[model samples]
Structure formats: C-alpha cells, structure tokens
Target: MNTIRNLFPEDIEELRHLLQTVYRAIYLYQHDRSARLEASMRAAIQSCMPFLERFKPHIPAYKQRYIELLKQPDRMAPYDLIICFDRAIYELHTRLKSGEIANRLPWSKELRDLLNERQEPAPESTEGDDAADTERVDFLTSGVGASRGEAAGVARVILDSVALAKVQPGDILVTPMTDPSFLEVADRIAGLITDRGGLVCHAAILAREFRLPCIVGCRNATQVIPDGEPIMMDTTAGIVTRIAK
Candidate 1:
C-alpha cells in the first residue's frame, strides 16, 4: 500500500464516532452479568467482528494516500488529520477481510504515526525505558512466606498468562497473580513471587506441593525484578532482592 500524509475533517470525525461505538460494545460484552444479557453482549461483540477481520490490510494503502495529500498545498484541514486517519482505518475494514491483510500489512512505527494524530517518529529506548539498565535496585518487600527455602536465579516476569512459553527451568517466576493456568510453569520455576495473594492463593498452595520457595503478596516483586536478570529469592524471609547481573 501507499503512504498517507494528511486526512480530511469529516473522515476523522466519522472514525472517532465508529471507535466510540466499538469501545461501548466491548464494555457491554465484558460487563454483561446475567445469561440473557450475556447472549445480547455476545451478539454485540460478534456484530463488530467483521471490523476486526477487515480494514487492517487497507491501512497501508490509506496511509499512503493520506501522506500524498499532505504534500499538496490544498490538502484537508490540518486539525482533521487524526480523524481522517481513523476514518481510513474503518473504511479499509469495510473493504477488505483479515486474510487479505494478514501478510500484507506489517506494522511499523510510521504506520502507527499515520493512524494517530502524531506524525513524529518513535523515541529511542534509554536507560529509563529499560528496567534491565537499573538492575542495581535491590529492595525487599515482605509477604506471606508460604514455602520455606532460599533460591537465587534469573527472574522471569510473566505478566500475562499466555507467556508461559518464557518460563524456563530454575527461573524465578514473577507475576501479579497465579491461577491454575500458571501450574504449567510451576515445574520449571525455582520459586514464585507475586504482586498479590496470600497463603491460600494458588501459587502458595502449589509451592508447597512442588516444594518451591514461594513468596506471595510481594507488592513490587514483578516491577523491581527485571526479566532475565539475576535475583535472590529468600522465601525464608519473604524477600526478593535484585542481584547484580
């Protein structure tokens, strides 16, 4: 697809209205409580499914057109650029399907800029952006020591349940909370550290069964420990310290 430079005011406004509708649909689907309401919510979510399947591929083409228009002296109003970009996204969905764009539209920073109001390039990563750069921060927050033992190993910050593939043997698993889904990684981790929970939490109960050093309710363990960095898990004292890496 070609590049986009600018967008028209009406296009932008229309896209914003559509996006608001999508958001409202998602909110309804998530908050639907009763079975009757749940069925309605599911229908609402399904109604918007076509948008997800379409439009993504056409982004590249629409973006190219927008860019070309921007180079012209009589282009659309400057303020309408974001709205136009959003409109293009919706229009593309209306024209194409997911398969059509699946391999066609590779996401890039430039594409993101065109899709949003901002046209600036993404900033480069710095020390502040990377937790690994500040690996020297070693502090301990107390929690319920469900399993008693001390183990030191690299930290694996698994914030999402889908990231179980990142778990490796003897790595310290750090997360906000653990459910039954986390049991898949229980065998590979040397210890478990979580942001919330108690002795009765799944992580605590599993730790005892696995005989792994477990620390629950360590409010900042996941944030303090950089993924892949060395860490000392002192479940005996319910503390996790960032080790110099």
Candidate 2:
C-alpha cells in the first residue's frame, strides 16, 4: 500500500513506454514462431541474468538494474523499452558471438576451414554517383556512418542462412546481425544493414572485407523494410533511404 501510494504515474511512464516497444519487437520477430519464441525468450532471460552476476563492464546498466529490481520485495519502476528488448537482443548477440549458430549455418565452417584454401579476394562492386543516387529512394532509415560510399539495390533480409539465394552482388543485405554463414555472399553484395551489430560481428568484419556500404544497430529495421524494393544505402553515414525507380 505504501509503495503504491508513493508511486506517481509519471514515474512509470517511461517504463511502460519501454515495455510496449520491446514487446512489439519480440512479437514482430516471433509472432509466427510461438514455441520457438517462448523457448528463446526463456533462454534469453536466463542467458542475461548470469552476465550481470559475472559483472562485465560491457554489460549495460539497465540489465543489471532489471536483475536487481526483480529480486526486490517492493516494486521498482520499470526500465526503458530498449532495455527490455535489449535483454533478448544481447542474449542473441552473445549466442551468435559464441559460434553456436555457426555450425547450423551452411556458409560458416567452410569459410573458417578454408581461410587458407581460398586465395581469391571477395569481389568488389562500385558504381557511379548517378547510379547510386538513383538507388537511394527505397531505404527507410540508416545509422551514423554504417558503411562507406554509396549504393542502391534490392534488399535481401538475411535473418537466417535458409535464404541464401536472396543475397546477391547488387542486393542490399539486411539482417538482425550477421554470422559467418551470411558471408558466403558478402563479397558479392552491394550493401549491409543490421539491428544488433558492433565492430566484432561478422557484419562489420565482412563489410570491411567486401568494402560494401554497411549499417549496424538499426533496431527493428527488418520490420519496416520490404523485399525487392529499391534503396539507396550509405554505410559510411549509416543511412538507408528508399530510392524509387
């Protein structure tokens, strides 16, 4: 009763806002895959809890707060929505970084084992200003300096390796993030976009490798983006704007 009395509705407004956004992302990504989403959400929560216990500097503070608040007797205010969804996102990031999905992705082990076997460099594709400017109309939004230079093309959302044919030399590659498996076409692609990428992820590594325009940490980018639409991609500025032909 005391806690409820103490509460000001505004104190929780941000938390409520965060909850809506985070839940929406989860639903968008998992709506069709209920069993998988439930199991994955459970796994995600478990995976994040221990990271707080281990205490890494890289661990975001809101995550630590979430774990700590969950232990309290009285209700604490909710954190922001980014933190909520980030809990799951970070878990997925950790899993991807750990290489658990590498074996599951067909394009991975071969690249790993064949590092010495393959001598030919990844192919590079660059076009004139007129061509790139023309492709800029289709993308929705981009981040700050995600890729270098400019480009325009069809988008291929590479959430999983099952969609290999979708990646092509001129196609814009979008994914939650990239693992080694998505690299099979990295050299052949024009641009890249990701929802949860940092300097170490395959998206960054291969973007530099192929010199493709790349954007990282565009959360929920895949949700609004449609397939086969023309887009202008600017990786250096981390922007993806639509370019209608």
Stretches > 4 Å off in candidate 2: 1-139
After superposition on all C-alphas, the RMSD of every candidate to the true structure, in Å, is 16.4, 18.2
Across 189-225, the per-residue lDDT of candidate 1 in tens digits comes to: 8888899866544466457656788898888877766
Error of 1 at 88 (Å): 47
Error of 1 at 166 (Å): 0.7
- lDDT string for model 2 (1-245, tens) is 22312446553443334333434333333324455554443443343344334332333564445455434412322223223334433433343344654334322332233211211122234433244533454547655343467878887877777787767778888888775466578777788888875443346545654567777778877876787777777765556787656
Off by over 4 Å in 1: 1-137
